[model samples]
Target: MLRFFRWYCKPDLIEDIEGDLLANFHRTLRQEGPAKAKRKLAIQIILLFRPGIIRIFNLSGFQDHFKLIQHFVISWRRIKSNLTFSLINIGGLGVGMAIAMLIGLWVWDELSFNKSFTNYTELAQLYQNRTFDGQTGTYKIVPQPMSRD
Candidate 1:
């Protein structure tokens, strides 16, 4: 039972919890008998399987952050040793990001055009499809009277 408890309990908390369980087991052993004491000990160890007492399977951010920092230092050293390649890689990345940002902004502007009007939800643009010189084209410049005479 002690071995079973030690297997699943968090390392930092094992001593305190094991101490309590042992104390209870001894008290039960004296008050009742060895049979009841062993049963109570088994129940106590099984009950300690709650989330608060379990050791987390994952490495916490503290350890992972140190690993990330170490990897970044190694990469910086490589980048510093290869200056021209690093510059080319960085410039290409910057240009690609800039182009992507510009295209995203243009798309947002196109989607939001004429959206500030009071009746924007009800507004629609009328496009005309015509054949000019045997070439077909779609145009949005629909002419209409602006005011009544």
Candidate 2:
């Protein structure tokens, strides 16, 4: 993770930030347990997976800003020249992203089902087996107490 962080971090801020992270990791390890320290380090590294934290590709010194503006201008001109194709691409991308977001939310909710309850740990789904038409079937809809308490 640290190696990935080094590869991903902005080149200008790598040295000082990496050193500080290492120092903080060691401090956390000493103050807290290994699990907490590892969690902290992992969280920090994950947080760096953002565009602002990633290294910029610009290498030119003074012309970088001009290059950026020129790049945007060229992009805008291309889009304008291919307005129909560009709109279609943008619409497809927007629909795909919206569908992906909705699926992600659904999966998150399903995984976290019943987690909001204070006594979720004590709760359990009850199941029962019954014979119907010479066949045995199991069902989770049986009426039963969720917890012993």
Candidate 3:
């Protein structure tokens, strides 16, 4: 009986209402028999089921909320219906992102390599054109003592 009352009563009113109900139930039980007391308690509890007595199911902005939920359901259905294609595309994206990160790191290291050097601005690269066998290639690597001056 107490559990039924607590379940129906609002949170803020539960304690006060429950205590009053129990007190009245005990008083009526002493005055009358168990049958009449139980009937009175049931009637009182039913009367407490009014608007402000119980929690309201207030669906504030229900239409907007439903539309957002519908959008999510549509997106989920699209992904679920094309599971194989989605997995393939996601895998490709992951691989491409990893390769891009590696290239970025390599470039960043090359650019910052000379930052610690005090004469970094004075440093220059040496390039040379050489033919070996049949192919001539431009190389950044040259033999030592290439600058004899």
lDDT of each residue in 63-130, candidate 2, tens digit only: 98889899999999999999999999999999999999999999998678689898777666667899
Give the residue spans of candidate 2 off by over 4 A: 1-62, 118-143, 146-149
Model 2 collision count: 0
Q: Pick the candidate with the highest lDDT.
A: 1
- Candidate 3, residue 52: CA error in Å? 1.4
> Candidate 2 has which clashing residue pairs, if any?
none
List per-candidate RMSD values in Å: 10.5, 22.6, 7.6
- The Cα error of candidate 3 at residue 124, in Å, is 22
- In model 2, state the lDDT of residue 59: 61
Candidate 2 lDDT: 0.87
Give the clashing residue pairs of candidate 3, or none: none
TM-score of 2: 0.42
Error of 3 at 139 (Å): 18
